[model samples]
Target: MKKYGLQLRAPSQQKKAAARPPLPPPRGFQEDEDDDVEREISRQASKNKALKDVEEQHKKALEEDPSVFDYDGVYDEMKEKVVRPRVQDREERKPKYIQNLMKKAEQRKWEQEIVYERKLVKERSKDDHLYADKDKFVTSAYKKKLAEQAKWMEEERLRQLREEKDDVSVAFSAISCDGFFPLREEERLRQLREEKQPSVEQPKGDHHKRGGDAVAAARERFLARKRAKLSLVL
Candidate 1:
């Protein structure tokens, strides 16, 4: 059984053993060292070529435009001729009706503003006139004159009031109380005293009672008078 097993080994193990080939011999140190040197040399050559290409480009640019070497001058020159966006002709682009309407609106606005300014000036002038005194001048003498005039006017008013009061008092004294005898000076003084005296305080209910009593008394007196007249007629 062992011999048969050996002969019938796995096909994968046989394939693996057959697939691998023998490796080549190790490289020499000198050859490896030569390869490193060649690689370094090639890298340096590439770097130098790149630098030379940049230098040549710079030289060509300077020859083409000497100002290219002067960066500030080149920048300034470009800036001076900067490309701006073209402005559209809105007047030409707009419809005729819209343009006419806009022009009319602008004219109307200007007219309205003018009218408003004129109105403001008129109003300000009116206000200044209203607040300012036409006859008064801005001086101490003028102020003193105005004060004296006001004082004279006030004194005249007081004198007129006193005269009117005296005339009223004289008229009151001449008034006859009973159609026969005019009020004497003493009687007038007494009446004035009575008028000045404080009235007696009465309760609200008493006021109504007093008023009713006075009305009844007056009615009785009127009846008496009517009876007396009737008797005289008979």
Candidate 2:
């Protein structure tokens, strides 16, 4: 067994993953535009061995095995540290259901419910010791600054809402004046009534003219009413 060092990425890390190597064409296979299905299975075993080597190295560096490193009053994994969980190698573990595993797989890939761990790198143990003591001070300042920011944010949000209300009121008045969109039909009708003109008066004296006009007018009205009723029924 060999010891190795673990390097963890910081929050500010923004590096992209390294580009994959160009793939070779499959052996005894034709090279069509969509012919990437048959991989060279011969190389898979080599790839697996390389992956195992890397995993072994990572375990030596980061993992706390069951039988290693027992210290006094404190188990050392992180700072004054702690004993990590005891992992066991089992020969006969029960197989998981495909549907449940599929659901978990979906969650892990898309929703990120699956947690991944990376160890923090310390330049020196002394620096870690300092942070443990002053974390409360840092936390307090951070909280106060957050509170101030939230207060301003809330105030601006309310101010925006008030401006929106004023805009709505102005738009209502403009639209009603232009008659584009009637916000309140009752209000529009009331305004129309206020701006109404008086009706003209008609003469009422000639008997023969009045009798003929009244009979013609009554027949015309009856015909108009009949047409309207017929139209409605149709």
Candidate 3:
């Protein structure tokens, strides 16, 4: 019979499988027992063929290159290079290093516990309402608010003063000698009476009283001058 490289079954094995009764539901709950059996046989055959191929390739490689696996005491050399030093280090230094690490860990844990206990005690002893009274703490924000309020008040006062001064200037413009300088006092009186009139309203404030009084005095003086002029004319 001709040999096949990777046959799933030989001709005699195929004849025997055909002659045997149908496998009894594949020993498990498979719906298609024939297909499941064929697939399982194919998988096993492939696995065996793959293992055989690997073996043949390994033998061919060894035949072609005999020096491929020439260890030549390399195992001993690797052991000396890697394993011996690690073993010696473990014997000589690992124990002491482990002891020092454990000591330092214990010391660190004790220090942390002490610090935590001290913090807990301090918190327990301290007053709960230490920062309750907001007014007791004069922060920069509070100071800034006071400064803004004072500045606003000062600006308001200055504004009122400016208004009062403006009113006084309007009421007594004839008294101020900016450009009008009459040669005779009588002409001056006439000019004051004719050209100047109280048109500006008085500002209402405690500081504006002086300006109001000045305006009233100027008006009274103008009236007096007019009366005297009238008498002289009579």
Candidate 4:
């Protein structure tokens, strides 16, 4: 069993190796995966380079000035940023004529208010008692008129009293001229007839039947009564 010249071989293993097919050429998906890996490696190399540069700059700054870092000293980016002004559209602006009309209207309204205030002040400045003297004069005139009326009434009353006194005196004089007893109205008429006809003689027969003598005596009596009334009036 020492056949060293030929290598020991399994006939099944050799047939399986020959029967296995070669792998297909690299696929589209595999190529895409390879490109992605290459891009990631390049991105990592760029990131490492940036970190190294920052470290070198930091080391150089430390060599120059060895002061402790102050985070508070750093300027805030938001504060340094400039605020943009608001932009206005041309359509938002009013026309010149319309703006001028509005301004004129406001000015007119202001002037009207000023004029109204001045008028109110002038009206307030007027005298409140302008007709005071005239009212006093009218009151005095009315009082004078009342006094004149009262004086005239008092004089009229006095005149009436004097007239009444004169009438009483006349009545007393008439009574005394005849006798102590006041004559009856018929007796007075008879006495007045006798006094007026003293020249006529007494009629012999009935006085009424003596027409001429009776007529003369009656006429004399009428004349005497008329004269008595006239004297009393005077």
Candidate 5:
């Protein structure tokens, strides 16, 4: 009876029963399991999309290749195409100042060579004719040299005259001061021609009638008279 009393009693005639926990739904465990399954499916779909995106990104990365951008090719190509070629063509290009310096140095060297040759010739000359009257020997040699020099000098003079027929120095320098008339023969001829030619003088104006050919006629007469006088003087 005490155990029975502990259980709640419902009045048979009452339409409403005491509020008991609602009866457990049918297939309650399966409904709970379905919720977990739907959540897992959504999670899996998201993971699959992420994986596909990653795979596509990986494929694109692999396909990307620059023909000669890698380290090994980069170094060799740079050396062959850019670095080594430039080095090979980098000649000993002296700037203008350095070139001028080198030219001066070469000129000095040539002068030194000339001086050395002169010294050698002098030493040889001295050794060959020791204790011999040096001036007499040198004079004889000088005379021989002068004859040889004169031969070439005459040839050069003729050559220059041929090249420069109108050279004032060659013609004028060869002449000595003299009567100088033959040189002025052409000028003399010109003067004679000018003297022989007739000249007319203009007489003072208003000597004749105001209108007529009288002025011209008088001028002709005066010229004729002057010419006759000059002829008488000559």
Candidate 6:
């Protein structure tokens, strides 16, 4: 059978190794020393030549333009021509009219602030007055209530004193007179016994009298009400 599309081949022979140049023979001690000295001398000479060339160019530039070295003068001129004027313009004061307007605005603002503060103070004072009035009303009402309570207490105390005095008088009256006649003493003792008894059963005549008085009072009240009704009707 024929070989496939591409035939496989062995790798080519390896390339020959490159030959290195032969190194020079070792120099004598004096020769190596002389070579090093020569190289150092050439390097230093070249460096000095480069520095001298730079110096000459700088000297020529200074001669061509004397102003190149006039640093302070140039700086002063630049400041005078460019920087100072711009700074002065930036820092310039406002015109009188503008200043006046600004002052007016500030004054108006201060006046408005003063007005607002006064308003606040007035409102605060009004509120304080209202609070004071409320507190006064409460305090006065409390004091009045306390006075009423004290008056009621005094009235009650007087009523109690009167009751106690009446009781003492009744007790004193109940004591019989010493060394009186037997009949009078007996009569007095009987009166005291009667007085000590509760008066739950009033006399029939007194009861009738009281009932008549109540009836008359009721008749008077009824007449008054009827008269009031008739007046409304009329």
In order, how many clashes per candidate?
0, 0, 0, 0, 0, 0
lDDT of 4 by residue, 163-191 (tens): 55655555555445436577799998997
Which residue runs of candidate 2 sit more than 4 Å off their true CA positions? 1-137, 182-234
lDDT of 5 by residue, 1-234 (tens): 346446666868858866898776689887999999999999999999999999887677657954523778777876788766566556444365688899768545544544555566777887776756655445787677557545754654475455344333333333322222264788778868886888664453433222224334444555654553344233
**lDDT tens per residue, model 3, 1-234:** 998698685456344444667665554566577678999999999999999999999889889987656677667787789888888988889889999999768545544544555576578558647756544556898678557545754654575567656656766563333333345788678767865786565544643555566667766765654553344233
Q: Which of 1 and 3 is the better model by TM-score?
A: 1
What lDDT would each prediction earn against the true structure? Answer: 0.62, 0.53, 0.64, 0.60, 0.59, 0.65
Per-residue lDDT, model 1, residue 31, is 86
Across 77-102, the per-residue lDDT of candidate 6 in tens digits comes to 98789888777776664466688899
Best by TM-score: 6
Clash list (residue pairs), candidate 6:
none
For every model shown, what is its TM-score relative to the native structure? 0.23, 0.22, 0.20, 0.22, 0.23, 0.26
Tens digits of per-residue lDDT for model 2, 1-234? 865799566687678889999898775555653344435454677799999998888678557664443454234445332322222112122233556688657534422211111111223454677677664434787667557545754654575567555555554554444445644988878767766956564453464454455445555655654553344233
State which candidate, 5 or 6, has the greater lDDT: 6
Q: Give the alpha carbon lDDT tens digit for every residue of 1-234 in model 1.
A: 335444654667444445667775567876898899999999999999999999999999989988777979878767755632222344455677698899768545544544555566577788786768665436898567557545754654575567556545444433332223566799889978987999885456764555456555555655654553344233
| Cα distance off (Å), candidate 1, residue 30 | 2.1
lDDT of 4 at 72: 47
Candidate 6 lDDT for residue 172: 38
Off by over 4 Å in 6: 1-27, 69-82, 91-234
Query: Alpha carbon lDDT of residue 24, candidate 2?
Result: 80
Instruction: Give the C-alpha miss distance for residue 137 in model 6, angstroms.
Output: 63
Ranking 1 against 6 by lDDT, winner? 6
Candidate 6 — worst ten consecutive residues by lDDT sum?
172-181
* For model 5, the run of ten residues with the poorest summed lDDT: 172-181
